[model samples]
Target: MPINTRRSARISVIGLRGIPDVLGGIETHCENLYPALIRDNPDLDITIFVRKSHTVTITNEYKGVKIRAVAAPQIFGVDALLHSLWCLLICAFSTRPDIVHIHGIGPAFFTPLARMLGLKTIITHHAQDYLRPKWGWKGRLFLRWGERMAALFANHIICVSAALERDFLKIYPSAARKTHIIRNAPSSIAGRQKPDNDVLKRLNLTPGRYILAAGRLEATKNYLFLMDAFKRAGLDDMKLVIAGTFVDSRPDYEEKLKKQVSENIILPGYQQSEKLTQLYKNAALFVHPSHMEGYGLVIAEALAAGLPVIASNLPVHREFLLPEKCLFDPDTINELVSMLKRPDYSYFLHPVAISAQKNDHWHRAGKEHMRIYRNLLPNSAILTPTTR
Candidate 1:
């Protein structure tokens, strides 16, 4: 039997902790993608699988989307994978979706099982988990094997950046045709006006020049190095605001960073939508010193805010940052120091980059995803059968 295309199609997106409270890239991606789909095709039925921990429930129809929450543990360490696996199993039976779009490798581990039950599976390889430094040799090996399995089993493998696409080609050359490079977009608040001085005061920051870096406090992010670079630059007036919750991977890394930097350094922890937008607006520049990024979504957000960006010279960062708006080679502290000391910094701002970012908004990203979903449907019969 083939999928019915004449009638409205029902699509379910599995994996992730859920929405509203869910954090990080994949969760945010789902948040943006689902609503846009509803706006574009009102006839399309969308069901988002979320965790029980999510506080809000949508009983009313908003833009033709439905939300369903399943009971599952919400833990971050080793148990995070377990929690997602349980949610996937529950979603498998409860929601008989036409297409099950799994967010990351944690859910891809169960893709074969989903296929065994006669459902089409699409996995987005959001990041190369194997490259993360927190994982030990054994963990790295497991993730490497898991990624290969995901590529082999998933009906379609979505890579967020060209760098990731290139990586897939090298590791799994045969699956290159299955790989799709769809870049992630900025947050919904990207183009909004910068918040006023009152908002900055609430966040405990003076209305002055500052550099911003926001992400989880993990080793892969290389935040400590960011602090060192900022210190070496010796910007007395310009402060560096670091935001996001801390994990235990680097217990003393944060303390050491705080000790080294001048009193100007501010760590405000996690922030909500309005505050986050204000921070982006108030910043003179945004610096991402991460050693690895599948796709630098924050960089996109910075571009959207019309701020100059100085990111690591990683391949993924280069994919988004045009020549005018970006400063590569974050590892070189001296170069970063030079960038900080420049009196005339307005030249770093690029209107073209800002315009490009607005065009690549989340709504557009969701529409692109819908196109992929339509292409993958069995009734469409557009995709070639996999030989492997």
Candidate 2:
């Protein structure tokens, strides 16, 4: 596929520890979107900034996409922010991309610098980081300042969900016109075959009814609350399986959850895609009890897996999950319990829900990004021919 002259020029993505996603949302987004963007415009050069320590090998091209690695020691605590700063400096001098797409608040702080270097800056406001429980007062203050500055400085701001757009509008009302709401896509594994039983055996999970929750073991995920709610609801038959890596920021919080949870609760930690898919398929229900999400990708994943969902009553969850499919309300544990007790309605997990997921699929997300890139590029540049 040759690059479409009318689509894009050169785009550089910053943020995420780099792709082939060893972990996290932004990385997954990049892995999915970049390849699709390349498919859409073959000549549209894409470079992803990655940490040196990331062991994922990036071949010269994956369906005509490129990956660029930079040397940056991802320290235990300050890795994300530090890596962003390193990427900003590197991108500014080396790549000189026509469009610089920065993911999350960590990279948004560098938008102004990219703009100063004559790059068209686009920032994706992934979530309300300031509101997260892990950030202290000072950290929160810094995040607030960063969010405001990034919103004001970026040429365009992309909101992953409508809920995020609403939050952005509340603070940066005047810049609302510059904002774009492009929801996060479901994982590409949506319709893929379920993994073998060996995967479950490796995780020491027996074939039993269970509720699955997958995300970082952080405070904002509110797994502790979910555990308490499950206990209070007297859900003895169904075990709770939490799948995600532990973040050091909340070691005590993890310990607290472990101490409080019932014997049925299973912390299998982080399971790769094949194993995760097996878990999703085998589970009786999928629950996302996060305090906040810019876009609930896991909700979409659960829906795609044809599983009923019980999510936080947050606006983001409501934006995607249909009323019948979702039970929202963070305050009422009893309500969640009640929802969980209901029989699984197969109709709620129809193909329509899976098809609805295409709206946010990485291919569409990449095309939407290309549209933004075209809008920002010089008309003359759009007409230039390029090699396949």
Candidate 3:
């Protein structure tokens, strides 16, 4: 699609390694979101800034939205910080997007910079990263500072869940007026024709015979606790299948988690597309023992797949999941183990899960987001014809 420079609203997205096929929460959220926004709103011009490494094969556009790759160091934690700084400069100098929307707290450090450069800034508070166990004292302090700066500087702040919105309001009471709640939505990808038989057969698995836990192999995800709980659950024949590989930031923790895996547990690293969908569809139960989440999007996806879920008892998880019985104490291995031992609830849960799925559609989320933008730029869409 040609750039509609006459359109009053020019929103640019930063933060996230990249999109289309990335595995993280923010990446998947953006990949599903912008397409819907472009389809629903005629005069919106959106651009996403991605890391160069992740956009090697991709062109300069995705689903009518512009894609710009900013140079980032290959280093782990520093990559986002550096990319965000570069993005701030790029947005200020050349792109001059009306709203420089930055995702996650780490990147939000540069929100003040974007604002200073005469760019209208919006920061999406994906999570309070300081709370995660992976970060050390300095990293935690930086993230806490980033959160404060984001709240202080951004023209608007969007919290992914009501709980997150409340958390921010509690800390920065002045930000209450600017902060808005916007929950994450699942992928727009429809289920494949059928579960690929070759994929399942190769893994020595059958439909509804295995348990699935999919997410980054990191400390916050608490995959170690899930693995231990699966062993203690005593379902010898029933396998516990884990998806997602370790990111570069946590090699030691990844190896430590791997050391605890038993024979009954299958580690299928980073399953995506057809394989991931099949895992969700066929699993007896979807287990997520995450210590934290801005919003537990995987739980929503599991519910969408009509798979029974057993998740950590986090407030964000509760926000999406109605049944209290499905939640377990994230710190307590016994609780998760007991939930794993319970009788299959697929028949009882199918209808409820499907209902929840219907409400959490990408189109609804996109419309809500567009509403926010419209409120900020009321005259954003003064439609007029142009001849090339």
Candidate 4:
């Protein structure tokens, strides 16, 4: 709650399915990041532009950050681009924000548009979507173009993981000077939810009798890989709970995953309530076998909840979880099976989980963003209510 200046910066945030615990990494990032920014810096005027399809109501604000909804197609490829363009148009014509901070590559395609309209621009590369299996040739190409545009046009680029910063620099060497690394922070709500056994009873699951894997049921998420490892481990008494929904963009993959999973596997779809919280709290272990990530938020969440994590041996995961105790090669079922078969989960409890829980705070992340915004607009001050 510090005021750094007298003039307020009007910031318009774009790119996301939507917020208030939507079922994606970027949504979770926005949900945690913006609220903290608002609570700590009253001088900053923050408005988030959202996709209308993601929500049921026309609410104007959330946790003091204004919300502006724009029509976006529910389909996959078209949704991000079209929604971003619409948000850009509104920022250019109506809101006229001092800083237009766009999240993710798809929306970064509009960075040039924001700059052309005399708005300062910032883009956060949450993940390299082009690397994900869900995207085809055209989608990948467009995302690549988005990276190029963001590198060339944005005033500054923020990467949620150091791995992303390295990956972006490999393709856009010129962006090295402007790009920055700011890892996503966990919300205070991480371990605050009261333990609910009702969730276990309703799902016909017993406490501490299940391994958890939570992410959108997509190919790149590699949920099937986890299933294979679990099957090979042959922990029949221990159930596997896959807690995410298929977005209909990958219907074939979804159907295949459903067919492939065994009797003990649970697909509860997307969960955001006490059930999800309870799942995280009571799980015997948390596993993430994603082929790619900007940052693994769920892994961090699991660590925060004091749940042991067994994740893909990706650099991003290692950045948070200890290399020796928390990872296995994502491509090899044998490595994952070995990890699953290990009887002791205590190795993940100490320094690895404790470190993640300690550092992944929204307040720290908000302050970092404030520093970036301040550096971008050195003379800008906080906006008073009268300015509206």
Top of the candidates by TM-score: 4
Candidate 3: worst-modelled 10 consecutive residues by lDDT: 378-387
Q: Model 3 over residues 33-113: C-alpha lDDT tens digits? A: 888888887567899999988653466888988888878888767888998898888888988777778899999988778
Clashes of 1: 0
Q: By how many angstroms RMSD does model 2 differ from the true structure?
A: 3.5
Candidate 2 — what's its lDDT? 0.76
Please identify model 1 stretches exceeding 4 Å from their true place.
Answer: 1-7, 53-64, 74-76, 193-198, 247-250, 254-262, 378-388
Model 4 over residues 191-242: C-alpha lDDT tens digits?
Answer: 6646555878877888888999998888888988888888889998899999
Task: State every prediction's TM-score relative to the real structure.
Answer: 0.87, 0.89, 0.93, 0.93
Rank list by TM-score: 4, 3, 2, 1
List per-prediction Cα lDDT, in the order shown: 0.73, 0.76, 0.81, 0.83
For candidate 2, the TM-score is 0.89
Q: What is candidate 1's lDDT per residue for 42-122, written digit by digit as tens?
A: 767777766666434434343466777666554444454565566566556876667878887656777777788777788
Give the alpha carbon lDDT tens digit for every residue of 171-290 in model 2. 889888889988778887555575655776765565547888998788888888888877776776778899887763566887887786556888887777777888888887788888
- The clash count for each model shown is 0, 1, 1, 7
Model 4 deviation from native, Cα RMSD in Å: 3.2
Tell me the deviation in Å of residue 323 in model 4. Answer: 2.9
Best by lDDT: 4
